[model samples]
Target chain A: MDTAQVFGALNIIGLFVFAVSGALTALRNDMDIFGVAMIAFVTGVGGGTIRDVLLGSFPVWWIAAPSAVFICLAGAVAATLAQPLIASRLKTLIWADAMGLSVFAVLGAQAALAAEAPAVIAIFMGAVTATFGGVVRDVLLNEPPLILKQDIYATAALIGAGVYVGLMALGLGISPSAVVAALVTFAIRAVAIIFNIPSPKFARPRKTEL
Target chain B: MDTAQVFGALNIIGLFVFAVSGALTALRNDMDIFGVAMIAFVTGVGGGTIRDVLLGSFPVWWIAAPSAVFICLAGAVAATLAQPLIASRLKTLIWADAMGLSVFAVLGAQAALAAEAPAVIAIFMGAVTATFGGVVRDVLLNEPPLILKQDIYATAALIGAGVYVGLMALGLGISPSAVVAALVTFAIRAVAIIFNIPSPKFARPRKTEL
Candidate 1:
């Protein structure tokens, strides 16, 4: 298979994991079937949708390829069926989610670079692609988004995307650069998960007029 | 001078109103100055950005016209300065927000029609353009989105966009249709606000296995 196809496969895997994470959230909230499906679809495709829209790519990725939609649906259904096991194994789910985040961040940067976006924009797109799905899901669930929570998630995406672009500019081939970037991202996230990295939050003002 | 410019001016007014609404929300939450600015910016432009991206319109509107950005910033600053008066005059703010909703809904439909989208997509884009900005602001503030709360807000945008598209399809001129549609939307939203309309919510599932 071509390099693009290989990356596409990786992304689909990431999409499935994200969908599962969304479904699990819905289940935790005791949402109805429609809510479960809606959350699944949004979490799986939300970041990519945002990325495509920002890039001005037409029809969005899932609308262009319905199989992606089906995959997300299937993932949600599977999570529903395996809820007991999933709830008990939250740690495993986080690891899988980290892997998905790594793949998505690299792919997002690659898509932006292909579109001839500036490096800074490409990196921002990468972080958006890796994180915005969860943000949307969290907002819908009335939880503070994971991006804003004390976590090292979004920063890892930025670093990975930056590394990939930098490697490409240094004359690395596409395949090698992408693989290395994804691995580096996964490593950073994995370390954060293991050591429990805390996000730096902006402090609230001490005084209120009211 | 032209039809588009006239509509563009109307949209800027709408943007200003949305920014003010966002700033008010930030003040109500006792957020800091940075939070107030961020909320104002998102509330003014988030909906239109989503619409443009979905329509495959590149560069985003504000990127193309820095004046819109300036308008939102100015509105936010003004709202911050006028917070005490704003907090006291909640009723007036609701009226202003309804006016913005009307104008944005019509403008969104007009933009979609100009892009040669199908009527259904055009109407959907209009509602999205009017409502999603508020959704983004609420999400950022960790509140239940007003769209999800008991209100006729989204319904007003849908009705307005539908009226505009239907009028245009019947060979009415753009200016007349947009103006009439905006008035219709404003009237519906005004009625809802005065009457305290409630939304029909989906019932939550009965039991959770976990």
Candidate 2:
């Protein structure tokens, strides 16, 4: 497949996986079925929607493409049906989330580049796209955002986006660059998960006086 | 002043109060100075930004209007400086938040109507605009969202938006309709707060079998 076609396919996978992750979270929180679908839909599209708005892409990608909405609903249903068989929902969620994060990071940067944003903004958009969906889901569920508290999550997306942008700038082919970047991001996340690393923090003490 | 000019003035007040509320939350969470500013800025413009994006208004409102950014930062600074003097931060925040929510609910509905959205969508947008900023703030701080948990918050916005739309449909003038709607919203919220009313809940038992 050509670069655009391959990226399009990966994007679908990312959306589906993100939806499942969101649905799982909603189920864990005891939300109703409609709430599950709504959370899944937002988690599937939240990051890219934010990026598109910032980049001045009007109507967003999903408004014109109703299939994306169906895909999210389907993911939510699948997650709900499979809940009983899943041996470890938390582990499944983490791995599925890692995949979604990696794919969206590259695609988000690519989109920003297409929109002619500066390199730095494109990189920022990449991380935004990769993380904001989960952020929205967590926010709605009243949970601490994994992006803020987890080890090497947004950082992995940033590095992945940087890798894609840097490679493209050096005249690398889009498909290979995208593949390499996504894999690198997943690897970083996997390592973090396996080793149970904590996200880095500044040394400044919390101000109790405020 | 004309309706548009009056609404513009109220919009600035809404933004400022929302920023102060966000800054106070960040301060309570013990976030650093920059974190305070970031949360304040997002809480100031996030709802309108989302509205503009969904309505296909390119670049969102704040990108073209840099003054909003400065206003939010000023609010953050003002809140930080005034922290010691404010005898009851929680009370101040609730009142400030009520003002922001009232103004934005009317404005959001008006914007959606201007964008030619259906009446139902416009009302939904009103609630989204009035509540989403606080939702974002609470999410970042890992707190339960006030909109979902507080009494009559989103309900007040929805009713206010409906009133605005209904009045305009009945040939009421913009300024009077807007003022009436905002006042009604604030009154509902005030009553709920004063009486310590709880949000309505469905009688459905929690689904533990998921």
Candidate 3:
């Protein structure tokens, strides 16, 4: 497959995994089937939609690609059917999320570069694309966002996007650059998951007396 | 003021009040000054930004209008300074929030109509525009979303948007339609607040035995 085809396939994979994760969250929350589908669809598209809007990409990406919506629904259905099997396999789901994060970080940065955004903005968009879907899902479920609470999630995406931008600036081919950057993102997340690293927290001052 | 200028002024008011509400939420959560400002800015712009994105309006509104950023910051600062006074008077803040919600509901539907979206979509966009900012703020703060829990919040926005759209379809002028719709929205919210009406909840089935 050519570069476009490869990236397109990876994007579908990202959408499907994100949808499964969202459906799982909805099921855990005892949401009805319709709510599960809605959450899954939102989680699948939310990040990329946000990135496209920020970059001023018209009509958003998914509008022209109805297949993406179908993929998300398929993921939701699959997850629902496999709920019992997956319930005890949280680690596997986390790993799948890492895959989605890594791929989307590179794709998001590529999109920004295509849109001629500044490198800094591209990197930020990469992190946003990789993380915001989960953020929206958590918010809808009234759970603390894993993006804010987890170790090395958005940070890993940011570093990976930075690496991809640096490589492109150095004249690396797009395919190789994307592969290296995605791998870097996955490695960082994997390490964090394995070591159970804690995210840094800022110290807040105590409430002052009135 | 002409119609554009009148709507412009009301939009600014909406932004300022939303920012104040966000800043208040941040303060209650014991966030630092910078965090307060960030939340205020997000709350001020989040709903409109979402509306613009979904409508494929490029660059979002705030990027072209730097004044909006400054207004949000000003609101944050004002709220921070007046924290004690506002804390003692929650009713006033609620009324101010109602004003913002009413204005935004009309404006959001107007934007969608301008984009030539279907009437149903326009009305839904109106609700999205009025409530998503608070949804975002509550999510960021790990609180239950008022949009989901509060009485007649998004419903008021939806009905108001429907009124505006319906009036416009019947050949009413923009200014008059906007005014009538916003008043209707505000009246609904005010009634809900006064009566302490409860939001409708869907009855969920009990967990099935494994």
- Which prediction has the highest lDDT against the true structure? 2
lDDT of 2 by residue, B65-147 (tens): 99999999998999999999999888888888899999999999999889777786677678778878888888788877766
Sorted on lDDT, best first, the list reads 2, 3, 1
lDDT of 3 at A37: 62
Residue-level lDDT tens digits of model 1 in A41-93: 89889988888877777778788788888888998998888876654645755
Q: DockQ order of candidates, best first?
A: 2, 3, 1
For residues A1-210, write the lDDT of model 2, one tens digit per residue. Answer: 898898988899999999999988877765545456667888999899889888878777775565777889899988888877777777888888999999999999999999999999989999999999999888788877878767899999999999999999999999998999999999999999999887787875869955
Candidate 3: which docking quality band? incorrect
Q: What is the interface RMSD of each candidate, in Å?
A: 6.1, 5.5, 5.8
Evaluating just chain A, the predictions reach TM-scores of 0.90, 0.95, 0.92
Off by over 4 Å in 1: A1-13, A23-42, A49-88, A116-124, A135-210, B1-46, B49-102, B113-125, B136-142, B148-210
Residue pairs clashing in model 1 are none
Which pairs clash in model 3? none
Predictions in order: lDDT: 0.80, 0.86, 0.83
User: What's the C-alpha lDDT at position A169 in model 2?
Assistant: 95
Per-residue lDDT of candidate 1, residues B1-210 (tens digit): 668887977888899999998877765665545446556776888889889877878966664355665688788878766654543535545765787789999989999999999999999999999998888887876766777663888999999999999999999999889889999999998888888876556875668743
Superposed by TM-score, candidate 2 places the C-alpha of residue A152 at a distance from the truth, in angstroms, of 2.3
Which residue segments of model 2 deviate by more than 4 Å? A195-210, B1-49, B58-127, B130-143, B147-210
In terms of DockQ, which candidate is stronger, 1 or 3? 3
TM-score of chain A of 2: 0.95
